[model samples]
Target: MALLYIIIIVAFIDTFSQLPIIAPFAISLGATPMLVGIIIGLYSFSNIIGNIVSGYWIDRSGPKIVLCVGMIFVGIVLFFYSIVTTPQQLVYVRFFHGLAGGLIVPAAFTYLGSRKTSESKGRIMAFSGASVGIAAIAGPALGAIISGRFGYDYLFFMLTVLMIGCAVLAIFFVKELQVISSKAASPQITSLKLTKPMLFSYTSIFLLMFTLGILTFALPLKVEELQLSAELTGPLLSVFGLVAILIFVLPTNVLFDKWNNVHLMTIGLVIICGALVSLSLSASFIHLLLAMMIYGGGFAFIFPSTSATVVEHSGEAKRGKAFGLFYACFSFGVITGSFFAGALAVSPSFLFLIGALCLLLIVILLYLFSWKPVI
Candidate 1:
């Protein structure tokens, strides 16, 4: 439990802290507004590739080695972020960062999701969800403060320190999940096709993460456009996290064990669409806060349900691949959102509207394809 919690903080701070600046830093390096997304996109793109490879490795070798190596690798690469002088260099470095850095998270999560029994899985996953909320509550604001006081380079330096600490934790404190011995023995994976629920898990998480990319990348720039203080963005962004803990994560943890998930997930999807529209329309700090709060609530419902879907559907033998593919969708959504959000930054509403429309389409597809329409 302590190991999982520690990794959660390390992952959250490490991820969210650097995300807000990836685009701005590229622009600072003489990349045009249009090109800023490329650097961020490259990271997600390479991260997608990393997910596939890391998934394979996690299944075979277990997550401990993968997590430690990825943390150390990313910590070292982030040091290079401080010295890069050009957009091209930043892009290359970010791609490498994603390729190697990608190994840590899915590996950590895969182990956690598969570590426990069916009856207690929700409890474990709830703890995981709550940790994300806690991190979001603190990480972004702390990141903004750090950047404001020291500069982005200093933020990177601090992140290196954090990742190294996480590596140390992985080495001495973290306990490895028991491998499914038969699954571990099989080296030949025939395909990556998922069952219906798992497919829904992948798609749902992808859409959710897509908005995260847009929200994370676009909102800071939006804050800048509104002539708001950059520091304000962190708290405004963290609003969603706060709401998630209250309305989504904790409640879902209890309900996940007993509830019919389809209705809950649909409601979450609706809330997410509303959040996109609200965020698109927002012009004031208060409005941004409201938008984020809605987004966070939707996340609270969607993530736990989706995680349960994955855990319930996946075989112990294939859990690593299952989670790996799940995160691959995560990277794709982030890449798509970051790149397109940059292109659409001229009018943020368009991105939000597009997101809402995509969700509507996905909802329809989910309804049509659902193998069991119980809810």
Candidate 2:
């Protein structure tokens, strides 16, 4: 279990590390703003494929193999990042990278979900979110520092080594569970079904990460506009993670179990909307930091809630597919947000405002549709 968390952390670290550098790296390769956005989005777009496919594989073969192979493929892709010279090549790299990465989280989450009892699901998932929060804290700062001091190539090489090492750890230390089988599970094909809880969970995750995509796409540009060095982007992002991690580990985490997931999601979305609006209005570094803190609070609320909802609703046999589809929504949201931000070529303020509105729309629909399920 500890090793599983470590793998999750490393996989996410590989992701968040690129947040600060991705824009600048593409620009260095002569990518236009639009092209940079496409380059960023293409990864998530292809990741949808990987996420869906991985579910079937995880159900059949088990998560250990998926994690190990995914890590190796991702490491190989990161190595290509060091050698790519053109934005087009970077696009190819990001697409494959997203695909490779798409395999990992579903595998880890499915592993956890299969084993977790109902009473412990929310708390345990909060810990999983905390692992992600830790990565969010470390990844950006390390990315900026390494890229700032040693250059992006070296940073990519370092990530490649770290991923490969984690893969080795997965192979040796990660335990393989006996894959649970039932009449429903023995068939290789698991029919993907959409239920109310799944719908709520999927919608919430999409909106949450969609806003994040916009933020990630816009933040570096926002820093540049404010005449701040790109290094500041790391700390700004870290603030969000720091706040989120506190909420995840502190006593507040218990709310995930005690509270109604939909109600909690509504409250969280309201906070996130406010935070996004505040982000659009931010004028200084301190203001940006405060907005990110608010965003993190909202994030901590929703992440555990939605993840627990998925586990609580889905049966063990279909858990892999449920998570796979759940994360596919995750990738799709990022793709839409990135493309929208880039294609519009709007001010960061406008992008943030749009994100706020989108989230507000979801919140409204949630209430109107009775997002809560009947027992």
Candidate 3:
């Protein structure tokens, strides 16, 4: 279990570490604002394809093989980041980087999901969310400091070593799930229809990540616009991770197991909307920190609820596929957010304001339909 969590952390660190640097890197290679967005979004676009394929393979071969393979592939791809001299070259690298990465998350998640029973799903997923939060807290700050001191090339080299190291550990330490066959499988086990709860979960994640895409694209530029060092971008983003970790680890984590998932998701969306609005109006580092804290609170609520929703709703046979599709939506949302945010070519303030409007619309639709807790 600890090794599993460590793998999750390392994979996410690879992701969050890039958030502060990716756009700037593209700009350094002479990418225009719109081109930067495309470069940022192209990763998620390929990830959607990787995710679905990875899920199918995981279901058939079990998670251990998929996990090891994905980690190695991602590690190999990180080397390309160091070699790219042009924005066009970086675009191709990002596409493959995303494709390789798409294999990891669902495998980790499926391993965790398969091992836990329903009653414990929420708490267990809270622990997983905390793992992600830890990466979020560390990755950005470390990436900024490292890239600032050493350079982007060194950062990618270090990440390559870490991924390869984790893959070796997983090869030796992670156990394969025994594929069980039953004679009396239910007819509906083969049904492809998604339940209302699954839809809500997918919708919530898409919106959550869509807003994140906007932040990822806008926040670094926001720091630059205010004449701050780009290093500040990473720590500013870490504030949200710190806040979210507290919710995941403290007594507040009980809310996930006790509260209605939809209600919690609604509250989270509303808070996130407010946070986006606050970010739009922020003029200082202090103000950005406050908005990030609010965003973290919303994130804490949404992540556990949506994750547990998938575990509770899907059977063992379909869990990998369910998570795969779920994260595909997640990647698709990021792709939409990043590309559109860049294409609109607005100031950071206006971009955040638009994100706020988009989230507010989601919240309103949730009520307009009068959604209930499916469980």
Candidate 4:
């Protein structure tokens, strides 16, 4: 279990450290606008593929093996990143990188879901999420420093080293899931019959990532609009992840356990709309800071709870595919949200206003439809 924690932390840090460099590096290689988009976006496309396949594979191959193989594969691909001489080659490399890395979440969550009781799933999920939050906060900053000091190639090499450490932890410490010998008791994984709650959980994932992806696209422009130092965006950006971590680290774990997940998610949606509305109207650093912090709180609330909902609502054999779909929604959300923000961002405030209104509409629909589940 502790090994799982270490693996999650190291894997996330390694994965995220590569984020900020992708587009700039592609552009540096004379990649055109569309090709650059392909270079950057192809990773998530391949990731969606990875998520869907790994769901089936996780059950057949085993989580420990799948996770280790995925980690090692991505680590190895990072080495290839250093040697790419053309945008096409980098594109090929990133495509595979996404495939390999995508194995982690579905497999890890499935493995955890099988092992942890419903009562305790909240704590474990929150712990894992907090690790991710810390990594997200550190990854871009660390990526910049490492790339600056040594070069982008060297940074990839360092991530490879960390990934190798993750694989080692997986091999030496992570326990394999216990297999059920009674085949009759093990229900066959049917067609992906998504239910109402599961469907909502997936949508919740998409919405969560939409907020994050658009923030990346829109927040920097907002910072520039306010005439603040570009450096201030770092703290502004970090507050979201930091607040999520704080909420998870605090007693909200009880709410995650005791509350209706759908209700928690609805509250989170409302708060995120507030964050976006604040960003849409922000005229100063303090205003943006408040919005970012609010966004963080909302993110903290939704992520773990919805994740638990997806897993909790799934049957054992169906869990892999369920989580696969859940994460794929996340990837799709990010991809679309980023493109949406990029396209509509001639006026950053207006872009955020549009995003906020879209979310408000969703909240209204959810309330009206009851999503059939809860508040």
TM-scores for every candidate against the unseen true structure: 0.86, 0.89, 0.89, 0.94
lDDT of 3 by residue, 68-153 (tens): 99999999999989999999999999999999999999999988888844547777888899999999888877788899999999
lDDT of 1 by residue, 286-359 (tens): 88888888898888887777777776676666677777888889889877766667666366666777878888
**Candidate 1 wrongly placed segments (more than 4 Å):** 27-35, 117-119, 181-193, 217-232, 248-252, 280-288, 342-346, 372-375
lDDT of 2 by residue, 1-375 (tens): 777788889999999899779999999999999898788767778899999988878877888898899999999999999999999999999999999999999999988776745648888889999999999888888898999999999999999999999999889988786665646464443445566666778888888888888888898887887787887887788788889889988988889989999888888889999999998998888888899999999999889999998887776667777888889998898877776787777888888898899789878987667644566
lDDT agreement with native, every candidate: 0.77, 0.86, 0.87, 0.82
Q: How large an RMSD does model 2 have? A: 3.1
Cα RMSD for predicted model 4: 2.4
lDDT of 1 at 272: 93
Q: Let me know the TM-score candidate 4 reaches against the reference structure.
A: 0.94
Give candidate 3 misplaced runs (Cα > 4 Å): 23-37, 84-89, 117-119, 180-184, 188-192, 220-231, 345-347, 367-375
Worst 10 residues of 2 by lDDT: 182-191
The best candidate by lDDT is 3
